[model samples]
Target: MTRRHTTRSSVPRTAVRVLLGAAMTWAGISHLTVAREEFRAQVPEFVPLDPDVTVLASGVAEISLGAALVLLVRRQATVGWVAAVFFTAIFPGNIAQWMHHRDGFGLDTDTKRFVRLLFQPVLIAVALWATNALRSRR
Candidate 1:
């Protein structure tokens, strides 16, 4: 037997990719600036690097990855792989912060903090999936 699949319209596909890219790009910049302290507060105490440096470096990396996602969507496979790696790389920071969980972020408990950490991976997955799915249509 044979199976058939439909493709997304160009407008919706373009909208999805562009919007995802723009959102992530803005978020990355926010990480570098306004969110830096909040992110730094979450940095696990055990990490050897200074919090400021770690925050700066991570922010820069995020910005770079977000840009790549935007421009590289046409070549989805490459962008998808890079996005996956970037997401995985930063996960430790999330874990560390959750482990330390000292309030803020309006969280009532450490468990809530941990749940928050899950947001990163989920977002990365969405970004990667959107790009890859768009690629599949071509």
Candidate 2:
């Protein structure tokens, strides 16, 4: 008989994961509704799709990922990696926002936008850390 050994996340990690998931879900919903125009401002001019379409698609993706993060405890590592990648993928849009001086989400000043750019990596790291993605499987 084979015994299954399941590792449990620490309390802090679980809390962080839930918070991140909730935040992402809220942001995604905003992307589709109240903050649609603000989100569109983040889409880089170089992206081929129309800004609204990109916003909508990304909103859907965020919602799915957020749900996965919260509900898929066993698959948390995978979700974490995906979330990290998503954050990385959208980083260029943040840069574009800074470069183009597009105002959105209270990032009215260039310094504010530039400072916001620094948070993407933090979010990526948090996602990975919260889900044990940074840990090695034994």
Sliding window of 10 residues with minimal summed lDDT for model 2: 4-13
Candidate 2 residue pairs in clash (backbone atoms < 3 Å)? none
Q: What is the TM-score (0 to 1) of candidate 2?
A: 0.93
Q: In candidate 2, residue 17 scores what lDDT?
A: 96
Pick the TM-score winner. 2
- Candidate 2, residues 1-138: lDDT per residue as tens digits? 989654555878989999999999999999899999999889999999999999999999999999998999989999999999999999999999999999999999999999999999999999999999989443
Lowest-lDDT window of 10 residues in candidate 1? 4-13
Residue lDDT tens for model 1, 1-138: 877554665456556667766776776787788877777766677778998888788777777766776687457657666777777777776777677666655664888878888788776766656666435547
The runs of at least 3 residues in candidate 2 whose Cα sits more than 4 Å from the true structure, single-residue gaps closed, are 1-9
Candidate 1 clashes: the total is 0
